[model samples]
Target: MSDLVTLGQRIRHFRTAAGLTLDQLGDRVGVAGSQLSLMENGRREPRVTLLTSIATELGVTLAELLDTTPPTPRAALEIELERAQRSPHYTGLGLPVVRAGRSMPDDVLESLVGLHRALLERERQAIATPEEARRANTAQRLHMRTLDNYLPDIEELAQQVVRESGHTSGALTHREVGLMAQKLGFELVYVNDLPHSARSVTDLDNGRIYLPPASIPGGHGLRSMALQAIAHRLLGHEVPTSYAEFLRQRLEINYFAAACLMPREQSVAFLSQAKADRNIAVEDFRDAFGVTHEAAALRFTNLATSHLDLTVHFLRVGNDGAVYKAYENDGLRLPVDVTGSTEGQLVCRKWSSRAAFARTNRTTEYYQYTDTPEGTFWESTQIGTSASDEFSITVGVPFADSKWFRGRDTANRHRSTCPDPSCCKRPDGDLAGRWRGKVWTSAKLHAHILSPLPSGTFPGVDDLELYRFLETHAADTEG
Candidate 1:
């Protein structure tokens, strides 16, 4: 009785011996006849991609529906501690949500919970209509104002990890510069503000891109401020070019769900078959991508744009869930600021040399970005060091790309090693009483030099419309 209830009675004995009909076997596999009669009746479990499209429309193969009748060699330290506590690296929902009702091994958890309740009842029957979700959010805000269709590739993997770590001289994080910008392909989001019901709106009416943890602190900055307060309650008050094409199709559905959960050439051949004294971790990419240590740190920072010498930076979330979007190289109009750093604090320093400490030691770094030699990793908690407790976050890289040269390189490297030493040289009433840390720890860096002024010409939104009207009047007088 349990070879997953005998593979749901051999998929109802090969769909009634091929005569077919759970609506003709869910219309030859696209799925739905009550989720193929709840996966032929073991009552659901089918998403190893719809059990390979219902075992290629029932001909059969996925190892002949889990190769039947072979159990019994148990206890190798309780089956590797139940395969490392039902690994997805230690549970971000995988092994069919870790074989639900445990004592582990109910016919491989009823054949991975009947292919995860037959692909969530065929994705609740392919949802969509509210006029196809407002015409796919008005054709994704006119394709993000034709922002050259798309290719910062996460600012060329953060300017190829500061030109292959040639060095910017100290202070780093933003999850170790977003795992060297996802080894180098690109995808990252970290928001913390922008929805106290947005004021003059118009990235084509904020289609969607948010970050709001009481507008920015944690449950990961309140899921990027509740995805910009649900794209400012589906664009009502203004800002509409279709709100950057509803955040470029929700950043292309988080870059096609991190390329179908880590498949950029099988996550660069499984992080190049480990061993360079190991470091990839986020729990070894959440047990090879089943996902969630924040979705394996957003699929290892989108494996840094598949490696144009690697780069990715979401130092934190953005587009009004408390803003953050930084990159460096070939889009050089740089900007950085997200300076409060509370929730699960971590503010290590060093973005280049002290031999870039082999790309950040003991890992964990994600400063999204708001300038720094030390003065803007969330205004360097007035540079009190030991990173002002309360789960702090503030790190930096990119030694060049404007702020008159990060305010004259923080006044000529005031005792260099400057990721922030009390705002790099402290003053202005000790950075206005540790500036009570809330610009929701800002971010922005993707800068590699195509025009801050080689005369190819740049500056738009009408030459930064008075610094976007003093950053939209300091995000509407701090919401």
Candidate 2:
């Protein structure tokens, strides 16, 4: 129903519930009873002031009065069918005409409703737009940040899994992970034909974990992926029902996998020793754990605040200068859009994240000391190549904490006044003054940043496929 009609009905309902007649409500809100009756009949639209006054008199919020929920699927189809039957185009088709006030068989109407519902569902699936996907991701990210990118329950579960694996201290190896999988009654199957986008898939009914042959060659990536699959089973995480839940489950699994690779106690000890050293670097930690730089950085954030009593920032910047992922507990201001989203926002050129892209060596680390309006932050960054693209990952600490980090004394210092054009660091002021009203730089659109995570309600799988798999496994167990 239209919002106006919904609001009118709500007003009438609330008026009656309040034990007040139209005349009484109109008197309370200083309006005529006839005007209130017109509004209650939806024959007249109420002005904002009148609506607010009426809502106050009825003891209801404006939103509550104006709330209009979409009809249920069956109701929606019935409404559509009703509208169609009245349409000249539909009546002109010469099919069995459904005239107004004419009764039809219950089964026939139900069958038609079912058919229309299926078609509507398919249309909805096919018409899933990019904007909808962006909204989903934005919501997920907001939730993740709201939880401070940490979950204590997941951490406790990770600790339990680590204890069950019989390895509580030191870096976990692939051999041990394989044995753990076997101990859990799951067979590891390596195949060359799995899709590149798919890292691993677990078949619970068959008790098998499938991995691409490329992921099995003695790297931490294989072990991490395997452990993630194992975590899903061990933690009893069911298929997520929504995008937010999906992202949360994936993050939990990732945390579990990282904890498996670098057990908490051992990592804390290593970080303690590393912190004692005068030159702290993320690469050093990566080498210590035999994992990727990005993985090490992520692990660092997990422990930095809780264990090390340090506030830090982490950034993963794509070659195209869009931020892929960012997390910070420090008072640093990362770039964000008007909606307060950090991902897909362009980094300042003077910042280490964007400046690292200009370096020739993709392997060596680049360090920069930048001064922002917030404060000075010293960041160390390194470029790495993934299967799809090359990106730079950075870990930064506040200037007060920079003394414990390597490259703190580096001469690569740059003052960045970003998100502001008139900052003193910008050299374009004189040029803009010389060529008044002549210079323009078009903003570059990075479409890849807008791409959704994947089709699944989870991060990596299709939700329907995941649900079907779970159902099949449940049936097999019951049989």
Candidate 3:
């Protein structure tokens, strides 16, 4: 039927838009790749079982398929997902989609499941094309290095924009920065709705970044989202997939923004002066370069860790993706499977409260505490900083790698626990001495530490020195 053919085309279009391929659809629907191709090409009308499989795989509903048109509402995505669960794909694979009659509205849950299924399908398809996987892997590996190579110019331009804008509350809206990029002929397409979270993918050949919204939450996540978006925009394009990787990418963006704000000569001169003083406050830094606190912190930390030879690490409860710790060695080595709070709240405990501790024992360890901001905190004893009521500290050493560490596979050893509720509250406090472990983050890790500037103050310390110190020293001094 022409209608069925048309529907197949629509499904194909949606699949591509969702960043999937035919083989992915097949796996999700539990059909072979060739079978999916036949269905898509309209060689055979999909049976009800196959139709349901296709719907679930695409995260659509049976009604959506029967109607032969894509649904516009978010609710449609849920129905499609439900239909997929009911399809023969699950049965074919001996996997049964749960039938929950008493559960709450299944839309969001179903949609999420559908997304995961689609991703699984895509991964399966990707494995078949070893060459493609290799190419993608190669591309990801080079993306950061190549982007790093071009950062000087990006920093300089960002600086100029800040100076020209003259608005520095340490917060710049995403819309505002996007408009600026647009003025410069860079188009902004937000993928995630978060304001401060944005990314810039580049058409590398044209030297242009296509700014996409970093998350899908929309305006609610606008502020932090915007900073990330602009940071990526500053980089030419092609971002690392995770937060740690993004941090490395942002570091490069910060460098680029700095270079743009202060040309190579001016930046050198500015750094020479600041390096002498070691007192770049967020406001002063913001004034000097047109960027937000978040952006400034990212850049400042990168500069300290990369060029100043200082170690900086940041950890915050919900902002683990924003965490960083600088180190001189390759990275922090800890046991793969060691658990408790060190993996979860190490950042919040250290930076948020500035905790202090003496090594309790030689073995791996962990701890947690709360303070009022005016009392004696953990760091006060060891580092000699004045005590604050708001401070708390927990320390942990790593354990040796083991089978549990390997987590059902020899190659993929576990790094940290899932950050779900009920996870340990203070990971750094429990330092286990044995395992070979590196720090955990959502960003890429760098091996070297920049040398301290001449000033007693760390060369790249920002207005927020207290937090910067914790970020820089946490990993090395933890054990």
- Residues 128-231 of candidate 2: C-alpha lDDT, one tens digit per residue: 24454445556766665555556677677777767776775556776678877897899777766444456787776677787767445547888888899998
- All candidates' lDDT scores? 0.37, 0.74, 0.40
Candidate 3: where is the Cα deviation over 4 Å?
1-121, 124-180, 183-271, 278-294, 305-353, 356-479
Model 2 misplaced stretches (Cα beyond 4 Å) = 1-148, 168-170, 214-218, 422-445, 453-479
RMSD in Å for model 2? 13.9
| lDDT minimum window of 10 residues, candidate 1 | 450-459
**Positional deviation of 59 in candidate 2, in angstroms?**
53
In terms of lDDT, the best-performing candidate is 2
Instruction: Write the residue-wise lDDT of candidate 3 on 1-479 in tens digits.
Output: 54555455556656666677788877787778887666655456778988777777777776766775543443344345545554444445776565323254556566566775775454333332323323333344345333322354555566666555553433445555556566555555443221121233323233334343455343323343334445565554552322233335645554554433333444344444664664323234434555433344344433443444333322222222121221112123211113211222233223222232333331221222222222211110111111321212211112221111111122212122323212345334346333337555575332111122111111222325434433443343345
For each candidate, give its TM-score against the true structure: 0.21, 0.66, 0.30
Worst lDDT run of 10 residues, candidate 3, spans 376-385
Report the Cα lDDT for candidate 2: 0.74
Worst ten in a row by lDDT for model 2: 69-78
Residue 192 in model 1: lDDT? 40
- Indicate which candidate wins on TM-score: 2
- Please report how far candidate 1 places residue 219 from its true position, in Å: 18
lDDT at 52 for candidate 1?
A: 75
Clash count per candidate: 110, 1, 112
